[model samples]
Target: MEAYNFETAIKPFFWVASDKTFSVCLNAGTYKPEIFEWRKDEGFEGNGYDWASLAKVFLEEKRPDLAEDIRFDPEADMFCAYSENPDKLKEFITGFKETCENELQIQDLFLKAEID
Candidate 1:
């Protein structure tokens, strides 16, 4: 079995709400075998949710295997996905961004801690 060290791996870019109530991290954009995580910001008290639906739909349609790894914690308002293939992850991320911008009508989001 192999182990992954995310901190040492390529850093992720985050998409966060304007109010900083929630965030989605696109871990290791093109870096192979990475993970994506989404969570509600600490101290947030709004009812806003569904941060993972678009990504989940994309994954389910394109990479069912990876979708199987999708995990959600409603209590924590978090979700995550682990993929061994970098290309596939990138595809999903692209779609996710587009969905967020167009379909979800979330325009206040922006990339955080982007890597060069």
Candidate 2:
């Protein structure tokens, strides 16, 4: 058996860049269901609930100073931002990674953390 790491696991997924750029990669998982699905039990339900909308929420929740710069790309099935910020990008990836790790079962998960 072989061990896996974050990059390898996420390599197959696409990333929503801040410049409204859609990175062609692998989609590990949406991690955020509420952003796509607007239902009470399903997840977050409010005025705005898509990726761009959620980005606003995340920005406000995290960076109040930074204005929300987000866009929705149906073709890519992801939300992107107009501003290019490393911290925001890292935060987004971290959130997605953490969610995938917590929600997905080890055996069910495609990406596994390296043992060593």
Candidate 3:
């Protein structure tokens, strides 16, 4: 599989811009076998995986804390970005939903998923 670019990150993921604000969970493993199968078939690190860098950059803009590349973490488990700050994550997800339309196109398979 091609390395995920911002434009290609939309597939295999549905922004959980959701209530995980106890902490931000940018991506998580999926249990669905089909997804898992696809992930394995594609050599993905995990299901629901997203290209983490774009997410980090988006969050980096709003975050004021020390940052490191998740890739450097041997223990890194997230498929995208993660944050201890709920508000920052919300801002990131909301920003992606509210913006990025012109910058990306959800994989046609995800076209029906809400962008807003």
Candidate 4:
């Protein structure tokens, strides 16, 4: 059986560039019951909570350095890591991609995944 893609046309990722800063925007826009159910045991109430819980585990347990340079905006419903230095933003994007792949089990996550 072929693997199905949860989101393709409108991928859950995007790139934002401005002046000398670059940011990787993680759009967890909306999630259904399965997401809430799957992570309920982890104490995530869904939506922003899901991102927070996942980021906490990924940053604290997986990559600590990336966490320091990242920020989540609840009002905008976006998680963005920006840096004036290209190398710094690149590093953050790499670790963020790993978090989605390893933690979220998004194996086919590529292209617009914010990788250089």
Candidate 5:
């Protein structure tokens, strides 16, 4: 199988909010990067299986403090996070890319019957 390069494959951009909070945005294929308000009407339906769930879990595991800042909008297919510290924001994005790559590997293995 060909290797997928996360750094070259996925690019993340930053948006500074009015309050000066640095927000990171990633476009995963068909998704367009945009700010989304938190939805109180709908509940999370991923149940730890989807990409959003995996990303949240990964962030929580790697950086609990930044995890709470994460937001994913399935309808918009956007993933975003806000951080006051630019360095922390950068770290989160780097970690996020790694998490995505790891998840992708597991998915590939499952599809290829290499894993049960």
Candidate 6:
């Protein structure tokens, strides 16, 4: 069996959107995007999972105050980032975190089952 690196496995989809600049860098983790100046500087952290899901996670993590209105279009690159209710967004963020942790646990369970 071949072992895959965690960071290397999910490096194909990571990007960043700044106020004045928008950039998309493919597999930013495996390849250096800093030299290209695609807004993926050294400080840019690659999404730890698949693209869209990671984007959502990143947004929620960075701004736990606005998670509800952060609807990412599956067919679009931009997120529908807006919300009139901060309280709802806060709730969504908390739920999203719990969902992520649950997913991690599930994955771990599956891996352990396979190993056993």
Best by TM-score: 4
Q: Residue by residue across 1-116, what tens digits does model 3's lDDT show?
A: 87845323543334334454222333444322332333343454433333343344443453334343222111234544444564554445455443334334322222222211
Model 4 lDDT on a 0 to 1 scale? 0.50
Candidate 1 lDDT, 1-116, residue by residue in tens: 86864332323434333342333354322321112233224322211123344345555554576554344333233334334444445445555555444522332221221111
What does the lDDT read for residue 28 in candidate 1?
Answer: 24
What is the TM-score of each predicted model, taking all chains together? 0.35, 0.38, 0.32, 0.53, 0.48, 0.27
> Residues 31-66, candidate 5, lDDT per residue (tens digit)?
321101121124332222233554555565667887
Cα distance off (Å), candidate 1, residue 69: 7.7
Q: Where is model 2 poorest over a 10-residue stretch in terms of lDDT? A: 107-116
Better of 2 and 4 by TM-score: 4
Candidate 2 residue lDDT tens string, 44-93: 23222233444444445444455443332322443334335545554454
RMSD of 1: 13.7
For each candidate, the alpha-carbon lDDT, in order, equals: 0.37, 0.39, 0.37, 0.50, 0.47, 0.37
How close to the true structure is residue 22 of candidate 1, measured as C-alpha lDDT? Answer: 30
Return the lDDT, model 2, position 115. 15
Clashing pairs in 2: 12-26, 12-27, 13-25, 13-26, 13-27, 14-26, 18-81
Q: What TM-score quantifies how close candidate 3 is to the native fold?
A: 0.32
lDDT tens digits, residues 5-114, model 4? 42342235556778867665565555333434544555544455455445455555556766666654433355555656656556555665554645344322221122
Q: TM-score of model 5 relative to the true fold? A: 0.48
Q: Lowest lDDT 10-mer window, candidate 3?
A: 107-116
Q: CA shift at 72, candidate 1, in angstroms?
A: 6.3
Better of 3 and 4 by lDDT: 4
Off by over 4 Å in 3: 1-50, 60-78, 104-116
